[model samples]
Target: MDSLKVKAYGKINIGLDVMAKREDGYHEVRMVMQTVRIHDNIKVDKASSGDISITTNLGFIPTDKKNLVYKAAKLLMDEFAINCGVSIDLQKHIPVSAGMGGGSSDAAAILYAMNKLFKLGLSKKELMERGALIGADVPFCLMKGTALAEGIGENVTRIAPMPECCILIAKPGFSVSTKHVYEKLRLNEIQSHPDIDGIIDAIEEEDIYEMSSLMGNVLESVTVKEHPVIEDIKMAMIDNGALNSIMSGSGPSVFGIFDEPEEAEFAMNAIREMKLAKQIFLTEPHNVE
Candidate 1:
């Protein structure tokens, strides 16, 4: 195929814990990550010219080498020694820097689409390996589904899909830098860590309530401290019929789990009316087929 189109899905961390600060300056983490239906549409086509370029519907996203999509294309071209170029068009729906893995997903989409567009015939494992060289979350984004992520979000183990439920995502008008959040985190001060295995078992049993009750993120302590609105969003989610609510990833974005679609819609509408969120999405877990 000369071209390919794919959807790059976003993710939410059901449980996140920092184990220790490693010598490499990255933290050791254990987390349960689930893919959501919220996504960005990526269309990649071979270019007649010999340079990589990107066009996106979102104005704020960079179109040059600084963009992950551009990096992904460059990586593929350099590694395979291909002389041809490609153009990427990104139709973004996922909120940027909202702990939703938007950039990583975009990067993964390019890797995946380029593999097909060029007939590279790379396996999923190989694609993930290539993705890891770009970002910690790229590997997970390439293999969209529920998984247990460790080793700074690079080591991923596919797990049973999350129990069926509605996921309501709320992002305030701010972004949290992953580096800043990690810098603020004091691993030694952490008193409790989520039961990662228990969450795995909950998914196996399809127990939504138990899974919701188990949701936690140690990073919230640091991110919320910097931006108290993160806590407020979580409280609002819980107060508005969410089975459980937690901030995803670094900060500034909170997600609520609801069993029924109507309940989720009600909560989403309530939050929307409050004008607390810059963007609100009523999405659900996506299981890779």
Candidate 2:
């Protein structure tokens, strides 16, 4: 294939737990990572220019080395010694810096597309291994389903897909840096951690209520402390018929799971009226099945 187009699906953290700071400087994290229906559309094709080029609908995003998409292409080109350049066109839907793993998802899509475009013949496991070099979250994005991520998120184990349900995602106008949240996190201050093992069991049984109720993020204390609006959005979602709501990742973005589709739509409408979320989406969990 000379070119490829794919949907770079975003993710939400069903439960995030921080263990301790490692000597390498990355935190030991245990989290249930979920792929959502929300995504960014990416199209990649070979170019004659002999340099990586990126174009995106969002102007504020960087187009150079700093961009994960560019980095992914560059990594493959150099590692494989591909002589041709690459052009990437991105139609971004996932909120940037919202803890949805948008950038990582895009990078994973590129890695998969480039492998096919160049016929590199790498397996999914090999691609995921390469993904870790780009970013911790990239491997999980490449995996794309329900899984438990530990060890800075590179160690992924796919669990059964999350219980089927309607999901409502809300992102306040502002974004938070994951680094900032991590830096501010004090493990000593945490009262309790989410029941990750129970969450996995809930997912296996397709028990949405048990799973949603168990969903939590340790970073919430940091992000919500900095921005109370996140909490407000969560409450709004729950008040409007969502079964449960929790912040996603090191987030400014919050997601609420609904047992009924009508409830989700209703929550979306009410959330829109409240004007708490800068960007609101009604979606569902995206599983490989």
Candidate 3:
């Protein structure tokens, strides 16, 4: 194929555990990553121009090298010794910096599309290796389903299916700086957190209650303090019939897992009525083929 359009799906952390900061300035994290049905669209077509071109609906996303999509195209071209340039048109639906892995997914989609479009014959392992250089979550996006990610997020092991349910995602107008959240983490001050092993057991047993109870993100402590609206959204979701609500990834965008579709829709309506978030998404777990 000369050109391709790919869907870059968003992700949620079913459970995230920060082991410790590595000496290399990245946190060693163990997280259960699950892809959602919501996604951003990426269109890649060969261009006459010799330079990569990018356009996005999201004003916050840069069109230059700072954007992960740009970086991915550049990386792939240089690595493969290809001279062709492509124009990337992004219809961004995923909120930026909301811990949804939007950027990472976009980059991964580009790599996957390019490999097929250009007949690069790259293996999935090679694609993941390149994705690791793009971002911590990029590698996981390559598989786009449930997996246990570890070791600064490069290591990925496909796990059992997460509960089949609906998710109500609320993203306030403000964006949380990931670096600031990590900086504010008082490593020693964190109290008893969720048991990751127990979470895995719950997943194995398909116990939503046990899984919800252990759903914790230490970064929530940092971001909720900076943005109280996150806490309010969490409470509103739970009150509106969410089985469990917690901020996804870093902050601002909190998600409530609902056992029933009606409950998720109700929580989405509650978030809309409260005007707590600028964007609200009701999505289900992606059942990857």
After superposition, candidate 3 runs with Cα above 4 Å error? none
* Most accurate candidate by lDDT: 2
> What do the candidate models score in CA lDDT, each in turn?
0.91, 0.94, 0.87
Candidate 3 per-residue C-alpha lDDT over 79-151 given as tens digits, one digit per residue, 9 for 90 to 100: 8877889999999998888988888999999999889878999998999999999998899999888888899
How well does each candidate superpose onto the true structure, as a TM-score? 0.98, 0.99, 0.97
Residue 56 miss distance in model 1 (angstroms)? 0.9
Error of 2 at 210 (Å): 0.6
Q: Which candidate comes out best when scored by TM-score?
A: 2
Q: How does candidate 2 score on lDDT?
A: 0.94
Q: What TM-score should be assigned to candidate 2? A: 0.99
lDDT of 1 by residue, 122-194 (tens): 9999999999999999999998899999998999999999988899999999888999999889877877788
Per-residue lDDT for 1-289 in model 2, tens only?
6788989999999999999999977899999999999999999989988899999999999999999999999999999999999999999999999999999999999999999999999999999999999999999999999999999999999999998899899999999999999999999999989999999999999999999888889999899999999999999999989888999999999999998999899999998998999999999899995
When summed lDDT is taken over every stretch of 10 residues in candidate 1, the lowest stretch is: 187-196
Residue 5's C-alpha lDDT in candidate 3?
Answer: 94
